[model samples]
Target: MLRWTVSSTDSFLIGYNDLDNEDNWVEADGTQHSYSRWRSSEPNGGVLENAVMMYARDADDWIDVNVESSRQFICKADIGASAIPQPTVNPSCSNGWESNGGSCYYFSSDQKTYSQAQTQCKSMDSDLITIDSEAEWNYTLGYIRYRYYTRDYWVGLTDIGVEGTWVWENGGKEPTGTYHWLAGAPDNSGGSEHCARLDRYNGYQDASCDGAIYYICEDDLYISDAPRSIQTTIQSTTSAVITWTTPLQMDSQNADLIGYKFYYWIRNKQSETTQSVTISSPDTFELVFDSLSPGTTYEFYMTGYNSYGEGVASDPPGNFTTVSAQLRSENYALNIYRIAKGVYLQSHVIFSTEAITLQHCTNICTGVLSCQSVNFHHKATTRAKTCEINEGTRESYSSDVVSDSDYIYAGL
Candidate 1:
């Protein structure tokens, strides 16, 4: 529900629905009002009108007239009641880069191999620039024409993983219907070219991966600059509310922004993986993440997006932990060993520990929310030296024969 307020000295249209009688005036919700704003000569209509319109001459000036009467009205938006609070607008780019299309681009001056160039970009938390549209391609071309007309620059396009299956370094499939390759380009010249390069000379072409070349790096603008004053509230043991301030200008002049993306993960499990939530709305600056692990600290970061692309990610403002959930019977289930000899669960390991007793191993498996089984192994040099805690139920295990008795498998 939203609330509206009248300006101090501005006339406006309100949700009043009643006959001309000031005695019957009420708000849209049928709430009775003790206050009156009628002008000295207002409500002159005798049972012939049923509408109210404020006048700008004075703060309390109002006039009652025919329902069909027309007049200019002032409009106001309530910030406190907005579904997503209005974010303070602020946008920026990192040093030595220019912002465009919701992203930032850096044209390197030095040359390096395709792999090395990619590594350099990664070191900056960016990647080799990938042109997803003709506009972006033209933008890059314009930059090259102005500053590096004849110089070759590396792009993120490649077919290195599989011949003839081109993909962007960002993990997107090759674009179709609008290829910008030069005549007879990407012919896999010399049977060794697997990387792609861009220049004014020949739009784009395949080159040797080991070939040294300058490269461009693309960083999402919103993600890099990020929103400010991020505030988070723990809603429950499994949910939290996150809010941030972004100035209206954070949106492109055309309001190309489409949404904000939230990336979060448990602090200890960050290296393994992260989860994401995308709230699609140019104006939505607030979000709620649910079904999160309880009693564990979580780190959160955000980035804004538009039709063009995603902006730079905001530095993680801080961390928040949900309240612990009430303990349940399943959480206290006994860790009874299930015997499965000569077989080891494959590719299910979530964690591993060294030199722990079988009893301790069982306890470890039970303690983890995802662990349902454990694999204990002993090498010739050290007896029971390793334990592999695995996810997934025992029923889903695919057994692989391991003749070594020192390698034992158990599930709880």
Candidate 2:
């Protein structure tokens, strides 16, 4: 019996096939080849295995194999050696840093605590690496493993601010579905582990912030400037549209403009209640907000972002008020009547003044052309009375009208 030097399963495809006729081989690109090297009785599979492969177990001789079979193949380039571009040092990055995906990365040679690493990065005008997407994570992992091998690297993730709530140093909360932690990791073991590090063998693991480790630094190539020319249009009684122009200085070469972040709330109630929405398209310049209270005023501002980070907000937020439901018809007759007691319409004031009685407030509303409602605030002890003329009626802005014991609402 003869012993084989190579495994029986070890085979590699050669770019030659005879699909048209048996024993008539041709190159993969449809050209004929005259050179022939085949194992004895090899073209046996015929039509079923028209492709040729080199079988290692049979002294690396050519054999017919199924064309659809998965096997490693060889490749040859037609270009001359000098035509291929040679790798050159990237001018955008510093001496020891590497440029990738429009960002610069620096793998530190010295070990330091997480805080020390962050300080070192900041000294160089960069930050400890914050992996934003899976592609970025994979690239960092591959680079470290290939270059440094099996080493722990400090990353910019910590829950020190609020335990179990990991946030980047830049204050962005950890986004879901973007990172995979090592199994059962970030356990905050012994109530002391707060910093995160990349373990080359598995994934991220929580470690003590004081523990020394190698680190990676990242510098963003560019960030989008703030959006410009913010404008708003009332679309309906319960809906409004906000539009803005793209920033003029947004760069598309080094980094990609990802989207815009919109911040809005009822004016004067921003500290109490604010909402934000992220429009995840670079080309979108408008956003529509529905389900708004009729005649309620809203203040909004927008900021653009790229893969690096969010930019500054648009200066001086724009404001708009939704149209009143009853005011949709232009020909409606003005007839003032008592709508509700202990109620007032908020944030649609056309004018306000002191009034001695409820009837005096109604008379003031009748005189103002834009006034559709009136709120009379009366104090029994001080004998003080005030009137608020509103541009929205109680029927049109029911949601904006709220109960207040000292006020009365009258609609036109």
Candidate 3:
């Protein structure tokens, strides 16, 4: 049987008759499998006529063969898989490295300094490997399994060539996620080159880019990515939160995932209403978003990424709804008093307590028409915490407000 990594993109050529289009290839025994096309002409015999037959265009006289004729046929992949060859930059001087994020990197640790390494990576729309998360740290550790203490591999994270500012080949200068250090690394040692890397044993380390170390590069793709594992919880009349996971990391040329991009929708007329949200930096498997409209049904899902490209979104996503305020927690001290005519919500902070941020207030004012107008004590660490929700239509205060020492908002 022939092996194939069928991209969902090029399946049209194979026709709808292909069995792979139906579901994940798994047998009753739970053995996963993939499909390969047999030579058209070969599968041409038998009353079932299941033997491969030559494609009409390529067959010419072969098409005249009797339906029962037995002829050896050659296989040709109708899918674009056999189309153009991927362009390679240094196919001769460089070797390929398979990244945990599902990408390919090419590095020549034989080079002496960083300049050459940058040049090589640049030639291929990529740069030296830059580690970002613990997942990535583990991914890199396995990639260099063949190489010993030998030398430090070159990563794209650096400030030396630019000084004071560090930028990765990933288009942004700021570091995302958590930063790690191998106790005392990126020291520039004697002040030469300062490239960052994840140590296999522990922490991050800096090395000269030109120091003869194998490296990795990245690729990125944002188009055609779908959302996955969607879950929705509708709380009250004005808001909801959507959560999901991705199939492959975004922009991954290869390596563990870095972050994700989310897109959501609500059925509109005969179509779905669409919107996008980017969670710039997050770990694998989870995300929480609250601030959707009340009583509106929404579908949410996400796609993953690393430094290179994005993969497809998940299938069989879930749906959710936003309930009414009547469905909210009456346990919020059941404070149902009139702020002005609009009847607003206010959580009493009994003491100067925990620190709070605007995100907390925005979350509280779920489904508000204007979340931007809310005022929150972003750094409040005491009972001073307060978020003034702008209801637009307010009435004079007619009742005493209840106290909520926690002053927290509800999402469900």
Best by TM-score: 2
Off by over 4 Å in 1: 1-91, 175-179, 223-412
- The runs of at least 3 residues in candidate 3 whose Cα sits more than 4 Å from the true structure, single-residue gaps closed, are 1-95, 107-109, 160-167, 171-180, 190-193, 197-203, 208-213, 219-262, 265-412
Where does the lowest 10-residue lDDT sum fall in candidate 2? Answer: 327-336
lDDT of each residue in 159-186, candidate 2, tens digit only? 9899988888655567424337876777
CA RMSD (A), model 2 = 15.7
Q: In lDDT terms, which candidate is top?
A: 2
lDDT for 301 in candidate 3 is 52
Which 10 successive residues of model 3 have the least lDDT summed? 12-21
| Per-candidate clashes, comma-separated | 16, 0, 59
lDDT for model 2:
0.74
Q: What's the true lDDT of residue 315 in model 2?
A: 72
Global CA lDDT computed for model 3: 0.46
Q: Please, what is the whole-model Cα lDDT of each candidate in the order they appear? A: 0.68, 0.74, 0.46
Query: Which has the better lDDT: candidate 1, or candidate 2?
Result: 2
Which of the predicted structures, 2 or 3, would earn the higher lDDT when compared with the native?
Answer: 2
Give the lDDT of residue 46 in candidate 1: 38
